[model samples]
Target chain A: MNEVPHLMEHIDFDTTFLVFDLLAVFMFAASGALTAIRKKYDFIGVFMLSFVSGLGGGLIRDAIFIQAGPPKAVTDSKYLLVILGAFVLSLIFHGSMHRLKRTVILVDALGLGAYGVVGAEAALQEGLVPLAAVLVGIFNACGAGLIRDVLIREEPIIFKPGQFYAAAAILGCGIFVGMVELGHADHTLAAILATLTVFLMRILSIYFDWQTRPVLDEDDRS
Target chain B: MNEVPHLMEHIDFDTTFLVFDLLAVFMFAASGALTAIRKKYDFIGVFMLSFVSGLGGGLIRDAIFIQAGPPKAVTDSKYLLVILGAFVLSLIFHGSMHRLKRTVILVDALGLGAYGVVGAEAALQEGLVPLAAVLVGIFNACGAGLIRDVLIREEPIIFKPGQFYAAAAILGCGIFVGMVELGHADHTLAAILATLTVFLMRILSIYFDWQTRPVLDEDDRS
Candidate 1:
């Protein structure tokens, strides 16, 4: 009876996916806008960074798969709306928000975790192999940060010694794969576990002051 | 009698195609390194900008075609050597070189032209459709600049209104397509003519201060 579709049936939207997607969008957009403000860039610059940081991972994934102009950036304008919304909100609360660095980091971790799971699940849905799915997840989580740093004129944080950002994404992806294999096919459970795993790892790494070594030494410069 | 591959190839080494490639490497590397220095970025930033500005177009084209990492960046290390050499040269003449902005623009135009032809030819070699090949050519010319601008924390010159940068690439690519259709299949002749076309177009556009409209207006700002 569940398989049957009626002409008059009211569609029930999936609330779980909606929540995580909105959370990820908000987190990334906030971080990106703040970074732009710190750099003293113009409004357009702020908008550009926010857009790239939020959509860059998905853009890279879709382009790699030859999807051309990824739907997240092209078809849907919600991402843009979210970016504009964040920009306005940030501008309004710019002074008060400057002291929320700790909060920003936590939200960033949440966004990273959510995006990792979303990217991995999206890849799996596309019938990608597990190895490829893991790669996609890693690319999704850290790829946007790389683009953001590059845009902000900072050395990309990924290649510099870091707190295993990619590693966290990989772990979350592995957990999702494991859950799928264990008959836990529910999207809600998979997303929560993956997101929590990444968030915990990131928070622990930050709390411990884990960081990567700078690639350049005194000798290299001279 | 002239079909022998084992015969001395040195006689044709000085042909237009070889010369164009050499000039392109020199000019593109200089432009890339100069941007890095101007941004006051560290050594890694310098190397990254130089490499991307020199080889980024090819990399993007290869990625689009799903050929994985671009061969130009990998097959030969000459590209790296050229960029490094340019960096060293820039350091040596740093003060005097800043005044050579006009010269840099001219050389950049040449690089743009050569890269456009090379990209179109490469796409044709890959059997891509004509429109795709032209697009690849444009990407090859403009991509490096976009990457450079992004790394230096500037709005990409492409998105900013001014100087038909992409338009020149498009025109050069269109000319290459027309020439190939006209049976001018000799590599040297085609490359030289196409390069000159793009270079002249770019120079004229810049001299005349041609520009485009901004993607977003102030009113559009949130």
Candidate 2:
């Protein structure tokens, strides 16, 4: 469709978006690899986790877009190379990376925002329902982290109370979808705006130690 | 394809296979709902887990079969109804069900076998590669339990050592695929044999307390 070409043109003109996408992949991969290393998984396990964490969300989204043909990750070699590079870097420099905790957190938040916009835009281009597009966007932003945490036998941090993780993505996705529906912005502009909104929200939440309260049991409430 | 009709014909002739398939759905749903209840999840969580555990594997398999149109679980209302029925039943009878631990275990094992045959045959009918068919069969049998365990924040029991869970399914799938490939058995006959093999193996393994050893760490070895 014209939407597909429009998206390709946008990416072709904005090489910065491509760069940020790759950066997001690297950060997500590194986070997964670090979790594996902390869990004392073997090299294979670490590599597997890194690959899944970097690519799983996009893969799921693509799977849902069955009419779009095979998923890009399956056909493209670049994704595999990026994940491999990230895993190697993490394996070799995990100690140093851990020392830069604050930096890593900030980069991860940026990656979250970038992924949200990218995912929502892709879904919208595919003509998904607006609500479905937003959900896909949120999944693209946070699904890999959920998979990573689950693989290591932890409840996903996003699903647990006391985290502002998925909420930021949801807000960003809503903004992008709303902008597109209202014809207020082009895809690229909407993506940029949505990413900035999510990034700022995530940062502020962390800065203010924002948290959600858990739902109490009926007995506890009584 | 001729294969699809052949599978449908087999199911139509032998209503027992259809019954087993439904039973598998119910058992898997019950298992998931019970896990959510034990974890103190809200009703929504219980329903989500039940639905996923009953249908996630087949949904994933169908998603991979992009050429096969929409996933059966999505297109067919029967799966949804069955899962809902199981969830309601689990909610009402969980206490009594827990008391019948042996019966629950046996039914679960039977479901595993039934699901293994059904998944492999479906994949084969879809003309998947033989190895891929077997893998799909194993996924169909074990994938739901893995998702259920993960949602509850536990390492998937199949991935952990000390059980012959997935191994039994693999053996059954291999037998079914091998028989069909060699032209030694028709689809219906092979499915029956495979199901019995898996069921018996699972029962015996549990009876004998079969286990697999964990990989020892290098530091531990030293």
Which ranges of candidate 2 are over 4 A from the true structure? Answer: A1-17, A63-70, A181-185, A218-222, B1-58, B65-146, B154-222
TM of each candidate vs. truth: 0.53, 0.58
In candidate 2, which residue pairs clash?
Answer: none
Reference-based lDDT, residue B136, model 1: 64
- Docking class for model 2 is incorrect
Predicted structure with the largest lDDT when compared to the true one: 2
- Give the TM-score of chain A, superposed on the true chain A, for all candidates in the order listed: 0.79, 0.89
Q: Residues B1-222, candidate 1, lDDT per residue (tens digit)?
A: 113233333446235444555566666666787777888888777777777777666676666432534466567676667767877786677678879988888888888888788777776666665555665677677767767777566766654355777767878887886677556555546666788888888888888886654433454332
lDDT (10s digit) by residue, model 2, range B84-142 = 79989877776667678999888888888778888887887788988988988888888
**Which candidate has the highest TM-score of all?**
2
